[model samples]
Target: MEHQAIDELPSGKICPQKPPKNFVLLVSVLLLLTIVQLYHPSIFRSLFLSKTIDSNPQVPSTSSSSSSDHSNVQEDDLPSITSNLKCDIFTGEWVPNPEAPYYTNTTCWAIHEHQNCMKYGRPDAEFMKWKWKPDDCELPVFNPAQFLELVRGKSMAFVGDSVGRNQMQSLICLLSRVEYPIVVSSTEDQRFIRWKYTSYKFTLAAFWTPYLIKSKQVTYTEGPTKNGLFELYLDEFDEAWTTQIDEFDYIILSAGHWFFRSMVYYENQTISGCNYCLIDNVTDIGKQYAYRKAFRTAFKAINSLENFKGITYIRTFAPSHFENGMWNEGGNCLRTKPYRSNETRLEGLDLELYKIQIEEYRKGEREGRKKGLKYRLLDTTQAMLLRPDGHPSRYGHWPNENVTLYNDCVHWCLPGPIDTWSDFLLEMLKMEGMRSAEEKKLRITNDTTLN
Candidate 1:
């Protein structure tokens, strides 16, 4: 100790380790800093390391009067329907069948209520007697031209099976009255087909998800509700369908036809593919359950993301029946005149499926609300179930006399009854108010989260 005489350490220099009275204090301070670095790295980073976090400045609050005034101004800014004429053609009653002017062989058809029931038949007629009768339950006739007014330049996608294609074609035809020319794509899937009218852009597309989940299109025929072998296509739901679709302002989906196909799958994995012809040992894979599960799956993906800000309108099931004997049995569709509006009726498993879908829809609404997602269902299934007279049966199929034209009631002719489905969609869009309600709903949802 004498020799070290405290080899006096220089100012600000570390002295040789000889337990000093304050050594424990120094160790304690070091240990506290180590704990801070381990537990609160950000604090250390901010103090020693150069780190910065960007933040937005606080926004000024608006007064209640200003908000009220803004709403009033918005109301004033809404486009007036002065130029729009109320067309009563949809409400016209069915006129008596016209005589076949020329010797021809075509059966005309029109949708009644919603079912594919027959109206009347004519042995000779160039045009089918299709009356645009409007009913109490029928949706109002919305002008497609008017709809495209605000939706111009926006992409609208209809995701589902063949029924979705029917909707696409119907929408395209409805908007044809406007000066715009429609460009339809060749392949189904996520192809681009456009309708250009002024500032509005209407893109009619088919995502071709038979089950809207993982159903495949195969060669074999399965029973009425279960058919088609599609194990190969069920792997990627988002990648196969949703990956390419984005920035959509409106989305319409329908997919009941595929449930009747041969096979259904949950993924690349097969669920079941029952034969359509034989009804024995049939699996209980109802379309309703499949649709609901898939719909919920879709909403979960949509709601989890912040960018999806659009209105999703789901068009319910479209009815199909060939059992009454396929136009030859008691089911004759050789009609030149449209059937009475109130005479339409629906039956069989189709009706049961329709009811189940409605229930699923209600469940979907609840799910969407809980997740801050906006999904609306267009209940056109009941409306379509009543329109049996609308089939092109015999009429659409038989272009020439003595030839059977409209035998199958599954598919609809162009500009036929399904056109009204598009009309319903347009009116629904309008009732939500002009300027795409989807955007408005999304805006409100986003604002709430931020505030």
Candidate 2:
């Protein structure tokens, strides 16, 4: 009947026909479904966006990954919102996530003794239930198998202080469900370590260059409190990481808390300045100057590394949440939950150090373009700054039995908020994959560029 309604012109050509009512209704339903897919795909199922992504989404060939990591999700999993919303994942607030904490202390053996808060009897478990939610979109849980596919045949090195190693450890624990890597290289002190995933040929390593430059720790004593001072050489690159990073495909640089320690600056083998080196006639130039110079040297070195052509990510400074007193004088982070967006702000040394890192990253990016190298930033500063409750605090030991530091407000607790940093990393990897070659070449930042 609908076809019989066609109109004919003078030349007997069928000019037009009205659309069927059912066809129009079907088109309207499809449009509504598309909107739902764009805004709220999870209404259908968990990890609902299982459609094949045009970007990198490769699963292992063997397919024996733990069922928990692959729970109702498909092998082609990607963060549903980050790739679609064009939003900044770093500028977000912590929200309740009942499905959080993919792995815990017993499940993952990579957690360090200090960060093993649960192992040492931490009181509250609520801190592990929160997840970062970007202002514009939702951030799904981290998929270990999906991340393994993203770097199946490549090498990733975490080059910085223990914080960088903390991130690497979190990553390993996240991937523990799929494969547990073997330590191919490790030092007696575990300062420098390497792990290999034989199935994927994926290599992970950590270099203990806190300064990212040539430096040494000097034993210094002052009254009852014993102190350690670092002699920083701003001009010379530390061959520990610089020489070995040539073979890596990815480099994650993180170090800012170490700069707060007593430091003596060197320029050409002689003392140039000091932050707290109480020796006579040595000018105390403060840590900011030394910190900037070291970062500049590190950035400049990345541009000059002979055969090192890989992506470098400078994770911004993660702040401390010491309340009422200094760390040495009974400081602690005792909150049971995360802070609201307005409850805290990024200020003081954290903000200053973050600015310096980003400033240097921009300069390094400009220089790297000439050499055809890629540089990116995993800006975790603002996000981590809110997670005061996610630290080990007094739980680092058995109630002050015999620990070096009684209060620890610097590093984060394992199986806690720091796991969200893995979420951020996976999102950034997906963002990189979604872009064309020219888009990746452009300089990206925490806020503006991503939006």
Candidate 3:
């Protein structure tokens, strides 16, 4: 063989040199990849080109920038959807709203006869025309559609006294505007009533547990004389509500007036004490003490429930606007307008009870949050205390020719101030729903990033 450099070899006569096996394999692989790139452009782009484009961002066009800026400006102009929107729905003035009294007594059959103040002959209809306006921000009008959407496929219960029933009735009437719910369950005693909106799979029920504690009426008779005694089990929960707590997605509890009534308190089946039990050496613990203990027991039972992912609300005392005398002493709420917060001092048992309820709720809220339960205070006392004109007075019942009726200053009139309670509740629900949704979104994003 003639000695020759590899590059100077003749075209026809090649030097006896073998190509490296690895180098040949590499060239073959490159050729295959080039063919694939020409045949399947998407795969090639995804494997190489797309990553580079994503890594190096391009400047946005003027139109696109302007569009984004406009969207951002629009979002800024709108009210914040966050929970930080600070507005006191409770402490505000009532402004005239021509479209007030979302539902009328005649239109809503749910209204108890006594609450039908408009049907009977309430003179001042102007009281129903006002809407609550927070000093800091405007309250969104109660939208029945929105409320129903938020509570879709959920069950809610009002577990408290007749006042709770009153609130339930107001909510039903408000929701009735969107669609009438069917009464799914009704009993003779009417202690438990359930209304269902089949379209949304929503059930609204009211569980009448007046004291929020087990109670029984005992009668003692001695030779043709009979006396009725009210006995309350301070440590026990009312079965009417306790049995159903696990089924509810939301529960609202209220108790104040019932505690005011005389009762003997028992704990663990033994007499603990008494409120106004006139026996000697059985010291009369103030009604407030009993009230506090009763609420504590109720909260304990509620918080200890298993599989309860529900939110709870403790509605503060709804004050009676009796003036010059008490309920039995011919007192009446005759004003046709709301009281200015500065014009009056909120004192007496109503204010005291309200304060106590709020304090207890705070304690419950702290404890409940630990156990995955949420508790909030529906503080309606302050705003309601201002609306003395919303009471039923003598117009709560139809006129009777032969009988005289005492004025009703305790329960509020339907199609009146009680409707505002629904407004406050709906707003709270909206804010809470927004916060919960935000939390869920954040949790999902974090989980995705981890994956």
Winning candidate number (TM-score)? 2
Better of 2 and 3 by TM-score: 2
Candidate 2 lDDT = 0.76
Better of 1 and 3 by lDDT: 3
- lDDT tens digits, residue span 1-451, model 3: 2334334666797667657989768877897788767755334533442243233333111110100000001121121232124545576787887767667778888888777887888877898888877776566656665567668899999988888898998888877766779888857567888889997899998888888888986654321112445788888878777877798899988987777666777888988777776655566676887788778878888888888889887888888888888776778878999888787767877777777777777777667756867776677887888889988888877667322336887777888888887777766675664444544565577679999
Angstrom error of the Cα, residue 65, model 3: value is: 31
Worst 10 residues of 2 by lDDT: 66-75
Pairs of colliding residues, candidate 3: none
lDDT of each: 0.48, 0.76, 0.72
Better of 1 and 2 by TM-score: 2
Off by over 4 Å in 2: 1-86, 186-189, 220-227, 440-451
Model 1, total clashes: 45
Q: What TM-score number comes out for model 3?
A: 0.76
TM-score of model 1 relative to the true fold? 0.57
RMSD for each of the candidates: 21.4, 9.3, 15.8
